[model samples]
Target: MELVFCLLFGGPSMVGALLELSKNSKDHVATSTAFTFFRLLEPHVYFLYSQYRFDKGDIGRLFIAGLGSSMLLGIIVGSLADKQV
Candidate 1:
């Protein structure tokens, strides 16, 4: 459970950190907020369902989905940055 939370949150933060390094200061706040809101919310929604005793695999699936979404978003951002530069 904790590992799920860590991955969902940590992976995005690492992505955000990389984005921050690449983007100008003016863009960091918007980018960070956008990442945090979407990335962290998924596991939490799964956690709420788990409170009702949903199977562990269901929660794992949610974590995986969130991680995949973040990775896709990161790729899009990277590609856009490449275009900009």
Candidate 2:
């Protein structure tokens, strides 16, 4: 069951990460920063799920929170980039 869950999420995650890295190949700093951020974020998320006993409600909350955070980060970064230019 855990293996099934891993395959379901891990495959897409690996592909997505590869594509992102490929897209940023010309920017070493961006690539490294992204990798480092994800490396730190993944463990914290996993720990939160494990601590919560992997409840369905908690998972849903986590998903929503992830989306919100990503959206907020995108907005902040876009604004910063605009300011820089």
Candidate 3:
């Protein structure tokens, strides 16, 4: 179900956004910044998720922790970006 939804909706939207970003003046900077940020964070996120003991019946707590962490990261990054701009 998730894969199907992503294929039908998220896939196209992401493709469209990428295409639009590519044509923009700051495409290189925007793409490189995004790629760099994801590259830096992806490993840490994967490590954290892999280390989490889902079988211990803490799946809900893990999910909430992940969600909160992501939200906090977004807020911090957004504020930093705003300050830089």
Candidate 4:
């Protein structure tokens, strides 16, 4: 089950990393792979942490909180990128 979850999330990430690797810059491979792994780890880490910290009855609150945080993060990142340009 975990293997399938990993493969599903990782397959595209690995493919993108390999594509960058072929471009012959070791730095791109290292960075992209690290980013991919961290991104994939995020939701699992959140889920586990929620399970440890919150009651099952709090699912609705957790869902709302997750959505709000994610949306705020996206907005902040977008603004930063826009500023960077």
Candidate 5:
């Protein structure tokens, strides 16, 4: 199904994107730029996903749900990274 495909494909690319955004030293050229671009453009991706029957409320709600989950995980990972570093 398309939802499975979306999850399988979008999940890793999204994680890789966030990892790249969080790491990388060349702030002016790569990480910051990619992060900004992704931040600016991500709404469009969610907008497309909102057209699906599975989506409730709207794109903003869907994105916020994802953002909430990501932040929870990010906090745990960030804490672990701090201990490691």
Candidate 6:
């Protein structure tokens, strides 16, 4: 498959950070493919979400900030979650 060949020809850095984090996972190729697929879709998904979520304000600000923006309120809880772990 294309993913297998990519892994074969490329270095670990080209594949991504997910592979580095999942070093003990049984299937490196599958982990890379999943992370790669998510990376491709994440930006588009955020763009679409900004359209509806911030209909009047500066959508670009939210898009640029991604998840860390206080608009989502997740950042507040993220601090708590990080402390627990």
lDDT of 3 by residue, 1-85 (tens): 9999999999999999989867856554445777788879866755676687444346557667888999999999999999999
lDDT of candidate 6 at residue 37, scale 0 to 100 = 90
| Residue 55 accuracy (lDDT) in model 2 | 78
| Predicted candidate 6 versus true structure: per-residue lDDT over 10-50, tens digit per residue | 65666677656768756555557778898899678667867
Candidate 5, superposed: residue stretches over 4 Å from native? 1-36, 54-58
On TM-score, the leading prediction is 5
lDDT of 1 by residue, 1-85 (tens): 9999989999999998897789876764456777889989977887798898988897788778889999999999999999999
The global C-alpha lDDT for each of the candidates, from Candidate 1 onward, is: 0.87, 0.85, 0.78, 0.80, 0.81, 0.69
lDDT of 3 at 85: 100
lDDT of 1: 0.87
Stretches off by above 4 angstroms in model 6 are 1-31, 46-57, 70-85
For candidate 4, give the lDDT: 0.80
- Candidate 2 regions exceeding 4 Å error are 1-52
- Which scores higher on TM-score, 2 or 4? 2
Models ranked on TM-score: 5, 1, 2, 3, 4, 6
- What TM-score, over all chains together, does every model reach? 0.39, 0.38, 0.34, 0.34, 0.43, 0.30
**Which parts of model 3 are misplaced by more than 4 Å?**
1-53
Error of 3 at 32 (Å): 26
lDDT of 5 by residue, 1-85 (tens): 9999989999999998998889756664655777888888876686667667546566667778899999999999999999999
- Spell out the clash pairs found in candidate 1: none
Which is the winner by TM-score between candidate 2 and candidate 5? 5
- Indicate which candidate wins on lDDT: 1
User: lDDT ranking from best to worst?
Assistant: 1, 2, 5, 4, 3, 6
lDDT, candidate 5, at 66: 91
Tens digits of per-residue lDDT for model 4, 1-85: 9999889989989998897767855444355777889889867866886878866557557778889999999999999999999
Off by over 4 Å in 1: 1-47
